[model samples]
Target: MPNGPTRYDTVLLGSPVWNVLRPPMIMSTFTEALDFRGKTVIPITTRAMSGLGTAERDYTASCPGATLAEGLAVRGEEVSKAEAEVQTWLKRIGLPPR
Candidate 1:
């Protein structure tokens, strides 16, 4: 709330291959991007194999009120094979198919 310009109830973060230096900063900026007081912040990080690494830590610290949920680790090389999985995940997260 202190850093954000506006408040957001829920945040869904999906990233694959988080650049080494960019990931932390991205997470920090995201934290600063919105206020999460009394809101549920769902952080989902997509990775090739590392899954969710320090992203969880950074998000946790940035959004103290957030309920840091389990993340989904997607393999970068297998994106094509994971379309169905992606669709399922999108559906689970309330994103209707196009």
Candidate 2:
């Protein structure tokens, strides 16, 4: 966090889904302060059931001028089973989907 997102073209932001499928309030504090005008922001989440919840919309609001990529959500009990999804996401983000 000290280095911040200044050097990167993408950011992966995440938190446990809480309170009717929202990230904790503090995430906004972290996000709202930054300028992400040309950055790609990805939301990742570990949720019991909300599955990324309102994160896409939340990030859209908090991080201004950022391209919000499709995010990854792994259920709390299913982390071990989500590797393929994670890899696919990473690949898709890194390389054009074909």
Candidate 3:
């Protein structure tokens, strides 16, 4: 957490382009393992049809106090087409559209 006013109350946990392009590259960030104290830290990923994969379980175990939810697992190739769906999902989850 930073000292000043935070830009996000909901942290969209996502991997970089390189990670998305690679396979079997499941990894976590520093904040992924912290106790978020019930704050929303939504995980979003681009996968090859395998929905949610192991991320939900992994995140739940890592961030004990955070309200981890079922993440979006859109196919990598369909990302552009799925933008609106993703934005809607985010909004439904209380996050602002990008």
lDDT tens readout by residue for model 3, 1-98 = 54211454556667533433432344455554344656566777778756666666666665666777656877778888998888888778776688
Off by over 4 Å in 1: 1-8, 17-24, 87-98
Ranking by TM-score: 2, 3, 1
For model 3, name the residue pairs that clash.
none
The estimated TM-scores of all candidates read 0.63, 0.85, 0.69
Give the count of colliding residue pairs in each prediction: 0, 0, 0
Per-residue alpha-carbon lDDT of candidate 1 for residues 4-94, written as tens digits (9 for 90 to 100):
5345555666664466412546668767566665555555555655666676777677776767655555666776687788678767766
Candidate 3's C-alpha runs over 4 A off are 1-8, 16-26, 29-33
Answer with 2 or 3, whichever has the higher TM-score: 2
Clashing pairs in 2: none
Per residue, candidate 2 scores C-alpha lDDT tens digits across 1-98 of 55358898988897889965899989888898778778999999999878899999989998888999989888878888987888898897783434
Error of 2 at 28 (Å): 0.8
